[model samples]
Target: MPVDEAGAKAKGGRKRLIAIAVVAVGMLAGAGGVYWYTQRGSADHAGEKQAEAAAAEGEAEGGEGHGAADADPTASYIEVAPMMVNLRGGGAQAKFVKVRFIVVAAEGKTDAVKGRIPVILDALQPFLRELRPEDLNGSAAVFRIKEEMIRRSTAALGKGMVRDILIQDLIQQ
Candidate 1:
């Protein structure tokens, strides 16, 4: 009878320990879930609030009265004339490249860009003339060329006058 009682006490102690461990695991899991929810949920809520505010403001300002162009006043595009330049291939290999691109300018600034096209071309000609056939071999070269043109165009036309250079056609021979 005494041995039976001791066995019961040991069994009860094991059950209590198991229960405590389960409770501890549950609490840790709950805490982790709450932390994850708070971190991820806040960004989504912020975006939703911004969108709602914009919609409310637009409604208040008579959204239908404003045209699409007026709603977001960004630059428009104007195509520049195609340019053909002789690339300096090593020795007498004689290579030529043709490129055509559009210039992004603020609304009503197309005419100014059009009038200054010659200056833009003059600024770009030197860079194009210096390119070797191998220099424009891959996509990386094309990206570098676009960046250079953007830098040159912005420099020639003053900051903000030219927004970007969009390549329309590029041919190498």
Candidate 2:
């Protein structure tokens, strides 16, 4: 009876070992699948970028005579004149801010966009003056400032006129 009991115990231990091995294999297979899926996505993204670059190169080589079609509609940019404003919230001493930017406009709207610079400045001045030093501390802050500038410019120049705002310079003293 004791010999039979020991044999049963050995069989149960073997079964447990087999179960653990199977679970480990399953986990490894799942990890491998996830890794393969992510790598596949990255490969696809790289392929797409390569395709785009190839298309751009082909256009450059083949579209030399088609000047109108070759022109990028989003290439027009209107430079905003430099602006200086006194910043608020710096105790008794006044902190000043200087900023210069470019407004990206639809092609052929350079003159109209340039004419609206004063209005854009008017919209921007108040916001610039109100900014505290802490508000412009990082990339996120700069992005927020650009977005605000775009919104203000769009409001002043009407929707779809200004595509983006490029901050040329920003200084605080």
Candidate 3:
């Protein structure tokens, strides 16, 4: 039997609404995928940048180590002579700086203090090894040792304390 015109119109209307719904669903899915793609790209870029920074820092540190290693361990010679510093008479101190010394080529004022190494080392080694923990606790302790070496050379040695006081190593021992 043939359908009436009203029935045919109703069927066409239903098909139209179904098409609109399907298109809307497809648009939503495509937009969501694009958003996810952009976010993934951003995350990947951030990770790459982090890796580059770490590599740069590592290279810098390696360069510094090589520069130090290439430096001459002895361009001059200053000996510690001997140390007789008393540690227990005052208090049981926790901070002590035991340093091995050598003489190095004078930089600016090394010549001015090269003669009194025997006298200066006599005063320096004992003094350095007797400092309390409070004395050797800061980052500036190395500078302090350098200054002390210079001062003692000027005070005990004529105007020269060998070439230069080279602190070979500083340890608590």
Candidate 4:
């Protein structure tokens, strides 16, 4: 009877040890899987960086072959004066948005676009002033703002004068 009781105790201990070992192995596997997932993302980003570097090198080589006349005339940009406007809705504290941008003009329309800077500003000021803080919350807000800027610029400068507007800085305070 004593021998049988000892044997049963040993068997129970062995089962508990096996269960602990299995749980430890499972934890190690989970950690390894997490490490692998994070490393895969970083590797993909590194590949993108390499591809961008290669493209930049290609552009540098290609640019050296071109002369002044070969350059695109509409590639010139006109800088706009920065504007600070108070936002429409802020109950207690006043909110203001400041922005600086450059205008890209259509082919042979650089002078026209430059001359209409004040008119463009006139059209843009009211539209910008009306924007609430919530209006500028997301990535889509930027796209909407750009589209509206282009529309206002075209209205001010007439059709085909303004090509695009590149926002240099946008700050909210």
Q: In terms of TM-score, which candidate is strongest?
A: 4
Q: Please report how far candidate 4 places residue 87 from its true position, in Å.
A: 0.4
Q: What TM-score fits each model?
A: 0.55, 0.56, 0.41, 0.58
lDDT of 4 by residue, 77-121 (tens): 889999999999956768788877778778888887788899999
lDDT agreement with native, every candidate: 0.72, 0.70, 0.53, 0.73
For residue 125, give model 3's deviation from the true position in Å. 4.9
Model 3, 11-113: lDDT tens digits are 9999999999999999999999999987885576455444434433332233324213125544344455434343323644332344555554344445444
lDDT of 4: 0.73
Kindly report which residue stretches of model 2 are placed more than 4 angstroms away from their true locations once superposed: 1-74
Q: By lDDT, highest first, what's the ranking?
A: 4, 1, 2, 3
Write one digit per residue (lDDT tens) for candidate 1, span 1-173: 99999999999999999999999999999999989977785665455445544543443243545223334456577778899999986655466888877776766787888889898999999999999866765445555676799899888988867766666556665
In terms of lDDT, the poorest run of 10 residues in model 3 is 61-70
In terms of lDDT, the poorest run of 10 residues in model 1 is 59-68
Q: Which candidate is the best by lDDT?
A: 4
